[model samples]
Target: MEWGPTGAAAVPADYAVVVDVLSFTTTLSVALERGIEVFPFRWRDARAAEHAMRHGATLAVGRFEAMSRGDARHVSLSPASLSEVEGIQRLVLPSPNGSTIAFALADSGAQVVGACLRNAGAVARWLAPRVADGASVVVVPAGERWHDDTLRPAVEDLWGAGAVLDALLDALGGEDEVTSPEARMAVAAWRAARLPDDLLRCAGGVELTDVGFVADVEIAAQHDVSEVVPVLVGESFRDATEVQPAAPKLRRVDG
Candidate 1:
């Protein structure tokens, strides 16, 4: 699951590792760190407001809209701004890539966890109990979209996924227990790349920088800085530390 919405149709795995390094997942990690619950939405449509209202959460108006308002009171998808927000209990994070993938995975009955470079190690540690129980995992690098809405493989996302996979392998004591080919490739790619500095010069990173989102890139590139793992429970993502385990070795089957 390295592109588009393919993870929705990917082979059923016990857990889903959704990575969107540009912002979504990174923002998720930050917000969850601050005790905010995130609801992944596919669109910022009228339904977003309804969903937010239902959850007593704030609907993100996006970075551009929030910037134009000249107010720091609103929460958007920006990781920096999200880190600054305080006292918010819940949020609606809508994205074409990460959120969409997460929504699909949740609908398909998978135990979904949001991951990024910032919280890769923590996420892997949180997921260790499940993985060690012989449960498989799908590492989805939710790539950016092209002009035609096709999946454009973003190097940042690949690195994010690789970081998480690598962390998982390390936790599992090596790749002997990991049989997924995609997982292995992700680990290999992350090991061969230049990391934070290289991530800044990647295509997605450059585009974000051009749009005055350099801070977001820097925030996303902070490796292993967070201990929060955003695990999707019901319709919202809450810090895994705050949530109790559903069942011991309870592996979910494909719906």
Candidate 2:
């Protein structure tokens, strides 16, 4: 919306969909699918460890640090690392972009949901009826950061946000009234862009691949393939797709 979590908070919506397809939310999507509860953190500090300990959960390590230490068994943030892990009931994932927005929205009076290309359709389908029933929704693209720790508007996130928005707009059927210009532009970007190939060439994708985490990008690139919709429940994200009433599925716009 405006800029940071502050701008996002300014907007009044029934739901805020936070997307970080590069890693955070993608791993979240995968973890939820595997039935693991996720707690999002903004910083990788001692607080994360303490929170994890307090919850009796496992603290996630940075992807680079995990790889450096050859720690594949308990890898915290990688979708590829999920296969190597076992018995992980809860996870505290630290991400500067997506996690910060999601955690900040915990008390924003609106429901918070984690999104990526993977679960955009499911999230859209879940929101469509509520929206038709007069519930508002806002899609937040958690852009990447710059070297100086500034926000870098990552296209991968735009695509991820757009993926959710495009489907939402399609499901609502009244794009003129139910959508904003920015939402229309996001849908345009999603429609015009070659998502799968462009994601592999995008900055976020290349960054992951450059560090040997190409699998993360590949996982993030999958479009609407996942059905797990992770909603922020209290301090952590839990899958909500199970308890939701069956609604009309989004008509997938395949290219």
The per-model lDDT (C-alpha) reads: 0.84, 0.81
Top TM-score prediction, candidate number: 1
The residue pairs found clashing in candidate 2 are none
Estimate, for each residue in 1-255, the C-alpha lDDT of model 1 and write its tens digit. 445478545667677889999889999998888888899999999998999999899998788888798676687989988878777888999999999999988866668889999999998997777788877777888998889988888878888888888888788888783456776777788888785788789988888789898899889989999999888888989988788646433455553
TM-score of each: 0.93, 0.91
- lDDT tens digits by residue: candidate 2, 1-255: 333465577775777788888778899999888888999998889999999999988888877778788755557588878746778889899888889999898877778888899999998998788777767777888887778987778887777888888888788774765467777787788887786789889887887789788888888889988998898877889899554522322323223
Which 10 residues in a row give candidate 2 its minimum summed lDDT? 245-254
lDDT of 2: 0.81
| Total clashing pairs in model 2 | 0
